[model samples]
Target: MTYKYILPIDTKNVSLEMIGGKGKSLARMASSRMSVPSGFYLTTSAYKDFVQKNNLQKDILNLAKPEIIGRTVSFESASKHIQELINGVELSDEIVNEIKQAYGALNGQNPAVAVRSSANAEDLPDLSFAGQQDTYLNVRGEEALITAIRDCWASLWTPRAISYRHQMGIKQEVVAMAVVVQIMVPSDVSGILFTANPVTGERSEIIVNSSFGLGEAVVGGQVTPDSYVVDRKTFTVKESIIGPKAQKIISSDKQGTILQDVSEHERSQSSLSDKSLKELTSIALNIEQTFEGVPQDIEWAISHGKLWMLQSRPITNLPPQPIEVSWEPTPPAKILARRQIVENIPDPVCPLFEELYLTKGLETPAKGQSRKSFFVGGGPMFVTV
Candidate 1:
C-alpha cells in the first residue's frame, strides 16, 4: 500500500506503541473478518513530524501556563494560528503518493470518508477522552481528505479539548494525535454498546442504546433510544426499554447531517430483533476476548442488514474489584486451635459461653505464650498448660 498509513486489515499485529489500543483493536477486528469499516490510520509518526516541524513544544508550554492557575486560555487565537500553520505546510510527494495509493485501494477516486481523531492518551483504562476531539464525516476527494486530516490535527487544541487535557492531568506536550480515515457506512441504525452493564457494573450483561437514522441522536442524548440489556452468557434479551423517539439525525442529501422525526408506526417498533441482539453480543464478546479485557465501550452501525463495529474502547470509569483467591490445599489440624471454658453461672448464659468457646476455637494462637494462673470469683482457674 502506498499510503501514509495502511488500512486496518493490511496492518495486523500492530503493538500498542505503533498504534494505540483503539487503533490496534480496529485493525485486529478488521483482520478477524469482523465488520469494521474500511479505514487507514495516519500513524503516530505523522503526529510526531507535525509536532517537530511546527515547534509545538513552545506552543504547548504556553498553553500549560494558564492551566496551572486554574485559568482558561482563549484557544481561538492560538488554535487559528496553529491550524493555519498546519494547513499551509505541504506534505512530501512520497507521503502524498502513499496516501493516494491507499485511498485508491479503498475504491479510489472520490469516496466519502469519515476522518476522526484517535490519540494515544484516549481510550485507556484510567481515562477516556471520548468526544474530546473533532470528527469530520462525509469528506470527499483527496484534497478534502488532506484538509480534513489537518483539521483533525487542529481539533486536538479545541477549547473543550484543551480544558479536558488540563482536567485529565495530561501534559499537552506529550500528547500526539492520530487520524483515522474510514469509509463512511450508510447507517440505518447506529448507537453504543456496553459489554457490561454501565449502571450496575454487572459483567454478565451487555447494554445497548440504539436509535434510527444516524447515531448522533443517541450519542448527543437528544432523543431517548430503545435500550436493550442482554445476558452475555445465555445470549437472551433480559430487558428492553422502548422510548418515544420523536426525532432522528440522518445524512443530508447534499452533505453533512440533518435531523428528521420518526414515523408514528416506526417509533413504536423495535429496531433490532432478538436474534440480532444475540449476534451483536457474540461480536462484542469476540472483541472483548481479542482485547483480553473486562469490558469495552463499542460503537456500532447497521447497514443493509449487516452490523459493523465502528470503534471500541475499554470502559474506563468502572472501578476495579478485589481479586478473589481460590482455596487449594487444606491446612494442618494443628494450625487450628480450640478453646473451652465452663462456668456454672446461669442456664441461659451457658449457651452464650458455649458459643463464645466455639468462636474462640477458630482463632490461632501467637507464637509465644506463658502459662499463668488466674482466680475467678475466688476460684482457681487454669489458664493453660
Candidate 2:
C-alpha cells in the first residue's frame, strides 16, 4: 500500500530530495538485496507539509537570518527558538495515522526501533553533516515514534547543525529533514567500518572498530573499541589493537538506551573474532564496490552471527592516496639532504621547475663571471652528488 508520507525501506525510484541522503542510501542498499534491517522513511515531503501547515518557514528563516547576516547572534538561542517552533506544533492526524500504520507493518506491535535524522544536505561527498542531527534509539510505541519523529525534525535546528549549515553555505529554507525508522538490531557486537584507512589514507586498507553491545558505545566514544586494520585485497587482518572494552550501551526494557559495565574477564577480551573480522572486511569491500569504488564510512552490527548494515556514507575529508616516496636522490644527485637551497623548499619540487631553475638557471654563472670566479665572488656553489 502506498502512503503519502511513508515509503518502505526497499522502495525503488527514491531520490535524495524525497528521502534525504540516509534514506536514499538505505533504500539503494535494501533494493540491492543487502542485509539491511526492515524500515520505512518518513519522507522530506512529510517534514515540508508539517512545516507548511504549522506556518513555520517564515519564523525559521527569520531566526536563521542573523547567522546569515554575520551578526553576533547566539546560535543556541536561535536554534532553541526554531526547534521549539517545530516541536511545539502538532503533526496532522493524517500524517500521524500513516506513521502508526507504517510502524505496525514494519515489525508488528510497537517494535523497538531507531529513528534517525536524514537531512537533504547531509552525507554528500563534500558536505557530511554527520552526527549534526538527532537519532533516537530504542524508541517504541506509536506515540513515542511520533514524538521521536518530531524531535528528529527539530534536531535540524541544533546549534551545531545550524552553525555547520551556515559554514557550508546551505540556505535555511532550502533544506528539509527525512527520518529513517529501522527495527533496532539487538547487536551482540557492533561498530564502524571504513572502506579506506581514514587515518593514513590508504585506499587498500579497511579499518574496523568493534565493541560489545549496541554501536552507540563505539560511535559515541563511550568506550574504546577494538581496532582492526584489514587488507582490502586479501581480506586479511593486517593489524589489531584490542581495546579495554570496559563498558557497553544497550537498550533499556522500556525506552532509550543504557550504558552498562562489562565484567572484568570480558573487558580484556577482543570483541570480534578473526572470522568475524574477515566477514566484515568482505562486506566492506562489497559496499565499496556498490558505491562505485568510493571509500565508505559504514555502520554495521552483528546479531546472532549475522551481519546487518545500518548505514553507509562517503568518507568525507578523506585524504588522497599516499604517494610512495624514495628518500634516495635520483641520478647524479645521490645525496639528499635538507641543506642550503633545499632548506627553503618544503614541498617536493616539480620536474618543470627543476629543469628550468635547478638544472639550468642555477648551474649557469652570471654573464661576466667564470665558474671559479662565481664561487669566489660570494656566489654559493651548489654541489649535486
Candidate 3:
C-alpha cells in the first residue's frame, strides 16, 4: 500500500507508526479542537524514503550494533558517523516541494516555525524518551526549515539516543523519525503543566513551571522558573514560588535563537497571571480527559494573551497513586523510627518480601521453630524490613 509522505496536523486517523508518538498526539489534539499551533507532520514515510533512497540503512544499523553487543565501537563514534551519513544526503525533490508547499500554507512570508523530532519509540507509557532528540525553534524560510528537518532526522542517532534505545532493548532498525513543523508562538510567557504532581505523585495537584520569553529556558533547564501548585478539584493555587527570572531565550533576527537577560523589574514577578493559571489548569484537565484519563505532561505558551498547547505526552515514571493509609503503628511496635538497617533500605518493601519475612519468618516462626521472642510488623511511618 502507498502512503503519503506528508499529512495535515489535524488528520484524525494518523497512527503512532505513521507519524511517531509526538506527531500522533499533536494530530489528535488539533482534531479535538485544542489550542494547538498550526502545523503539519512530515510523516515517518518521508524519513524512511530518504533513508532508503540514500542507502544509509545498512551502514546505520551496522554502526548501531556495536552499542548493543559488547563491542569496542564507542557510542560517540557510531553516533557521529551515522549522523554525518544522514546529514550529508540530499532529500528527494518531491519531499522538498511538499515541505515548501506546506510551509507556504501557513500565515505570512517565511513564517518562523519550530521543527521537532517525533520518534516512533518515544513518548510511550513506559518509556518516555524525553529530550532524546532535537527540536529547532524559530526556523524561517525553506532552506532553514529543510536543514532543521534533516538535523532532526540525524538526531535519532545521537549518542544518548543510541545508548537509551540499546538499554531499553528497542531495536534500532525499527525506529523512524517524523517531524512536527508548527508556526512559532512568540511566547511572552511559556512553561510546562503537569496534570498530576510528578514529585509527590498526587493526582489532585497540577504543577506549573513558568518563565519569560520562549519555553526553551524552562524546558532546557537554563533557568529556574516560577512554580505554582494548584489543587485539581478546587482549581485553587495551593503554593506559588517565584523563581529568579534570570535570562531567557528568544529568536534572533538573522536566524536561529539567542539568549537575553530579563529586566530587573520583570525578574521578580510571576510569569503567568491568576486567570491564566486557572485557564491553563482547566485546559490541562481537559487534555488529561481526552487521553483517556492518563496523567499528562503538557507544554504550554501564552502569545498575546492567548494560550497554545505545544505538546502533551503521558507522564512517565509517575509515582503510584496516593492512598489514605493511617500512620498509627500496628501491634507490638510502639514507635517507628529509621535505625541503621532501615536507613539502608530506602524504598518501601514489596508485599511479597513483607509477607515472607515480617509475617512468616518473624511473626509465625517456621514449622518446628518455637514462637519468636520478638515479633516484627510493618508500619507506614518507617521501613521495618
Of 2 and 3, the candidate ahead on lDDT is 3
- Best candidate, lDDT: 3
The TM-score values for the models, in the order shown, are 0.76, 0.86, 0.84
Q: Taking the tens digit of each residue's C-alpha lDDT, what string does model 1 give over 191-229? A: 889998777778888999988877767877999999998
Question: Residue by residue across 168-250, what tens digits does model 3's lDDT show?
Answer: 89999999999999999999999899999998799989999999989989998999999999999998999999999899998
Clashing pairs in 3: none
User: What's the C-alpha lDDT at position 30 in model 2?
Assistant: 92
lDDT of each: 0.72, 0.86, 0.88
Q: List clashing residue pairs in candidate 2.
A: 332-385, 334-385
How many clashes would you count in candidate 3?
Answer: 0
- Ten-residue region with minimum lDDT total, candidate 1: 373-382
- List model 2 lDDT by residue over 297-343, tens digit each: 99999999999999999999999999996444434444333446645
- Which segments of model 2 are wrong by more than 4 Å? 67-73, 327-385
